[model samples]
Target: MSKDFLEHKAFVELFDLHYGNLVGFVYGYVRDEEVAKDIVHDTFLTFWNNRKRLDLSYSAKSYLFTLAQNYALNYLRHLRVVEVNEREVSQLLEAASDELAEYDERYARVEEKLAQLPDKQREVFLKCVVEEKKYQEVADELDVSINTIKKHMSRALKFLRDELQGESILLFILSNR
Candidate 1:
C-alpha cells in the first residue's frame, strides 16, 4: 500500500506473478494471443506510470485486472472500426469493377456497330466525330461536296442511334437513376 510497493523490485515481482494470468484474461476478450499479450504489457506500463495515483483501497491485482480489461475492450472497439472500414472499401472496389466491366462492354458494342456502317458513312463519321474535322475539310480530303459529307455523317449517326436505342438507352437511364 506504500509507494515502495510500486518500486522497481516489487513491480517486477508483480509482473512475474500476474503477466500470464493477465494475458489469459485479455485473450478471453480479444481472442488473439499476440494482441492479448500486447494489451497486458500496455496495462502494466499504464499501471507503472500512474502508480502514485492508484487507489490504495484496491488490491494491485484488482487494479491490474481492471486496466487490462479496459485495454482489451478498447482494442476490440478499434478492431471493429477497422473491419467496418475494410468492408466498405471492399464493396466500393466491387462496384467500381462492375462499372468498369459495363463500360468495356458498352464500348465494344459501339465499336461493333461502327464496323457495321457502310464504308463511306463510316469514313465520314470518323473524320468528323473522331478526328474532329469540319465537314468542308472532310469533303476536300475525300474530293466530295460538303453536302455529301453532311449526308454521310447524318446517315451514320442515325444508323448508330437506331442500333443502340433499346438496351443501351434503358441501361443508361437506369444507371443514372
Candidate 2:
C-alpha cells in the first residue's frame, strides 16, 4: 500500500471503530435506522475507494461522519422530490377524472334531449350533424327530397338549441358541425 493510503487491516480497524458512531450520527439526521446504516456503509465504501486521497490533517472518523451526513441529506432531498412529483401526478389524475365525469354527465343530458325528438327529426339530426353527412346525401339515404331533409334538419337544430339553452358543451358540439 502507498504511504498515503491505509492498509486493509488499518482500514478495517477504522471501520470497526467508527461504523456504529457514524450510523448513529446519520440516524439523527435521517430518523430511519436502515437508511442510516446504509448511508454509513456507503460512506465507508467511498472512504475505502478514495483512500489514496486521504488527508492526514483531518481525522478519518470526522471524514466518515461528514460523508454519511451528505448521503443522508441527499436521501432526504430525493424523498422530498418524490413527494412533490407524487402530489402533482395525483392532482393531474383528479382533474382528469373530474373532467371525464363532467363530460359523461353532459353527454347523458344531450342523449336525454335527443330521445325527446320525433323519430324523423332525430334520424335527420344524427345523419346530417352527428354523422357529418351532407343534406343531399341524407335526403338520398332517406328517399326524401333535399328540401324535406333541410326542413327536418332545421327543426331539429332549433328544438335542440332551445332545449339545451345555456349549455356551452351542446353549443360547442353543434357549432363545430
Tell me the tens digit of each residue's lDDT in model 1 across 1-177.
666755988899999999999999999999999999999999999998998888869899999999999998998999999999999999999999999899778777877888999999988888887777899999999999999998998897788788987534532332232
lDDT of candidate 1 at residue 7, scale 0 to 100: 92
- Clashes (candidate 1): 0
Which tens-of-lDDT digit does each residue in 96-169 have in candidate 2? Answer: 99998987787778889889989999999888877888999999999999999999988877887888786636
TM-score for candidate 1, please give it: 0.84
Q: Which residue window of length 10 is worst by lDDT in model 2?
A: 168-177
Model 2, which residues run further than 4 Å from truth? 1-6, 168-177
Report every candidate's CA lDDT.
Answer: 0.87, 0.86
Q: Name the top TM-score candidate.
A: 2
